[model samples]
Target: MHSPTLASIPPEVLTDNILLRLPLRDLIAISACDKYLAILCNSDALWQRKLRLDYDFTVPRDRPLENVSLKTVYQRIGSPRLFVWKCEHITHPVPSHRDFCELKVDRRVVSLVATHSAFYALDDEGKLYAWGEKVHWRRLLTYKFPFGSEVLPVHIKLPTPIRAISCGSIWITAIDTFSHVWFIPDWKQAYRIVNPMLEQLSSEAQVAQVESGWRFIAILTRSGELHVVQPRSGIPNPGQNLELNGSIIWNTPLRLATMPPLPNLPAINVGEEEALSPKLVKIAASEATIIGLTDQGHVLQLSIPVAVGESILFEALECGKIQWEYLPFLSEVEKVRTDPMYSPPETEFEKMDPWTQHVTRFSRVFGRCPPPPYGFLQMPPRIVPTPPCILKISEIFISDNDICAYSTGPSSTILIGSTGMRASDRAEVFPAHQNRPVAHFARTEHTAAFLTPQGKIMGWERTARGKYADEPSMMTIPDSTKGWLFLSITAAGCHFSGLAIEWEELDADTTNAYESASEDEGDD
Candidate 1:
């Protein structure tokens, strides 16, 4: 095994020369020597060198996401889903909204991390909202006393507004007032679950990544080495004076590895060999529990151990089964190979003729689709040629078709102007045409603020089932920009993929009055 004797009288060893240069699985065992050894393990210079030597680490800040907003929301439109905020003459790199379907930022951003819980969004200032709740919230609420007599408090707030947080499935790491760190279980708020009393743990620890699963927390020191600590065992009360250093209590951690890339949510795919209609195609991966970040800025994937849950090697050693396993639940879904699965089955396929519409021969990327019925589309009498200045958008809803148009931003009412249906595929496409929006509804809880050329930032709210206002919803930018106004529709699930923008000249009376007020302020 080529093991070296530590008693050989060598005063010290350079990391590259002796330790970090060793294989990662070997490094963890060796670093358990002391806190000084722990600091050495957390060295990035060592990690970077190891990364370059082993994995395809050349992503100079990987940015498949930048195709939308830049890295920081403050520096740019942090998400591809947002409209880059632009002032009259100033181009803001940061946009107020990423996607039209973006969760409305009522104010305040909080992070929630706990054992066996999916990350949740908390606006302590507003409604308790959640996204990516693949895991149940109720389970987390009763973290400490999970089962009996403990009637857990429905609402639990940290001593202070939690600015940032992270979890390790069973444990929670949070930063609060004065930047002090604290942790607890889901049941801690209901019952006070304190730390395991490890004195060796530094009081000044800063935990990061409240948004990722297998939640990671890094303790950064002024010297820059990052130390990671594991949750303690739920053993019975310890003696008054238990020495903690070299206590053999810490669980050995795994190092960062170059994992697989996540797959994209299904997008619209149509071509010669095949054609399909657009609907809700969920973008998930079989490769589950891939840790990622989501908040204000960077989306860097932090390296963490794969499934080091209860069955950890230490526990397995205490019992038997080393519980480390990869999360393969999400990545194993029976991928709908094509859209046909959503339609009817074999022999009886002809029955689907009445409900769906299929486009033939037009091969163009979304948005600026080529002048319809031109060379691209074969125009089998099944095709309809939309005029020039007009854009053929993805039908808002395949069930009831409506192509939303926009001028500036979404208005109080999106002129669902084109309600008269056309049917080449269906002889009964539109018999109940009243020549107006098939439906007139009000904008409900959804909100979007679009800046007008007149320098007015107009806020809009969507009208939907007062019922769905209670459901998880997102927003989208409207591509309805025309001459002087912008319009679009929003219901439970509308997305803003390609919203068209237009410059409008609002009435002079309002513009002049605002100008006069501005001039008065300038004189003052």
Candidate 2:
């Protein structure tokens, strides 16, 4: 029976082994063991001192914002990929850790509007989130003739555990704590917001079915078509009806008669064969392009030309430009370069091979690398490819867990940053891994900037290979990109917030910092 106190421990012990680390739970337990340990652990700055032993706060805090993890402003999403693009000059760079904000959903976000795009999620203490934005279209919610024909809206209870929501263009869909399926029309209960041009939906259009594992919800009809719907409300509305609450935003019938399975294909999965009705899906976006990843490592870039039928294998998706159709699948990274449409001007070979996205897609391409083809061309000049007519992104970038693209614009440019510097470079719409040129960024053609915590701006030159770039000079930006920022994350998992310096002089800053570090070295 003893009452221990902080006075017992020697002062020298506190400073000894400053870098030693103890398990967090064990430290808490040790503090609770007796009164003496408790006081010492609770000292003015003891916890921070102990924290420093195991963690490097300086490194973490000083990490550039642009270099943080592949997170996003909307942390509620899972696997957030940062994207930055300019129309005048293409300068999209693959974001490291600093780009993304952490998004952790209590559950997964899986909302499939059509084959082109499905929804993923992220979360920050349930305070923020961002879902997929599909093409926007309106379904007629209410169409009653003013004279006499009454258009009664079908009634449904408001959803619960839902927050904010949106729908895809060809198919209006939404997501919440639990995602839903709806054929959205422009009718309103005053409280429920619908797309203004909403078309009337069919009865079996927008019902949400709780998917297995509670990972996501499915938007399908009583028949075999799929679409996405809005999510449920996080806050519950006790006893509200349609007029008092909202009309059921549901879907219009999508009659798609695809081919049946071809003879060469293996027998259908045992599980799929047993299902009452096969869960078949096809996605279509209004104008925005979407890529679909199947469980088998298959990738399909979506367009709106329907294939013959369900009989076509997953790899056979090739057709025209429609709002909704199969996203043409790519067998090799090289295949991503071929023009899916017949337009010759639109064709460029796939040079920037995106890494495997095992988290989202089930594709055969994973772990498989293809040799260079016979006609494969070497790296070309950093000329920005002709922008797509619809302003859709022709290229996508994937670095580690992050992906980005130069999807649109009247311009083209990309910006990349390092701790001591930032660089703005032109993005060759078609950059291959081997032939990719760092010289492309030297022109500042599109003018991108990298920001830092110390209010520093680092300009960059696209170099073939070198620790320091020798050309194009540096840029300085005084104003931050404001609230929104481009984050950079390092391979070591360090994060750095980036601000665009309105004006940056590389010769001045780099020379100073370099000289200072050199002097310090000489002092030793």
On TM-score, the candidate that comes out on top is 2
C-alpha lDDT values of all predictions: 0.28, 0.28
lDDT of 1 by residue, 1-524 (tens): 76775534242455667764665445655667777666665555455445334321211221112122111111111111212111111122223332222333333332222122232333433222333222344454332211112121233344444444444444445544334444444422211122332222234442222221233333433222233333343322334324232111223342222222332322223353122222111110001122211111111122223455643523432342321121111111122111132233344334333122222122333433334443432311121111112111111211112222211111111212112222111111111111112121212123323222221233333333211111112222335333321122222112111111233344687545644653554456
Error of 1 at 272 (Å): 56
Clash count, one per candidate: 47, 132
- TM-scores, each model vs. reference: 0.26, 0.30
The lDDT leader among the candidates is 1
Q: What would the TM-score be for candidate 2 when compared with the true structure?
A: 0.30
Task: Report the error of model 2 at residue 261, Å.
Answer: 5.4
Task: Judge candidate 2 at residue 220 and give its lDDT.
Answer: 31
